[model samples]
Target: MRSSVPGTAKKFPLHPGHPERICWGCDKYCPASDMACGNGSSRTQHPAEIFGDDWFEPDPGADDAGAGREG
Candidate 1:
């Protein structure tokens, strides 16, 4: 039987990571491995904690990113 819920698959995408979004399933920082939804989901304070927005990509060393003077 078809589900009444709209976008049923969207509610819980099978892969759990194709959209490159923070996995709501594992709640951990990952590149969309094989995350599965369960009672083991964890929570972090910052977005970087999950994706590490700073550590992974260090300063690009450019005028825009490494600009010392304010213009």
Candidate 2:
């Protein structure tokens, strides 16, 4: 199970190939186009949404596409 200190938060990127704009931030997988748990706010988005596609690049050897953060 995923564990973290309370009050702390983490962000996950949207899966690149999802047909619908789905949120990868948590296990919920809420769709960006029709967010059910967003409470009017768009579900957590990837840096690429605010920045550009190049905002985060995939690591050459890493298996997961959104494995790292730029800090």
Give lDDT per model, in order. 0.43, 0.58
Candidate 2: residue 12 lDDT (0-100):
50
Task: Please tell me which predicted candidate would have the highest TM-score against the true structure.
Answer: 2
Model 2 TM-score is: 0.35
lDDT of 1 by residue, 11-45 (tens): 32333323454444433343344445442444222
The residue-level lDDT of candidate 2 at 15 comes to 35
Model 1 poorest 10 in a row by lDDT: 9-18
In model 2, how large is the Cα lDDT of residue 34? 66
For each of the candidates, give the backbone clash count: 0, 0
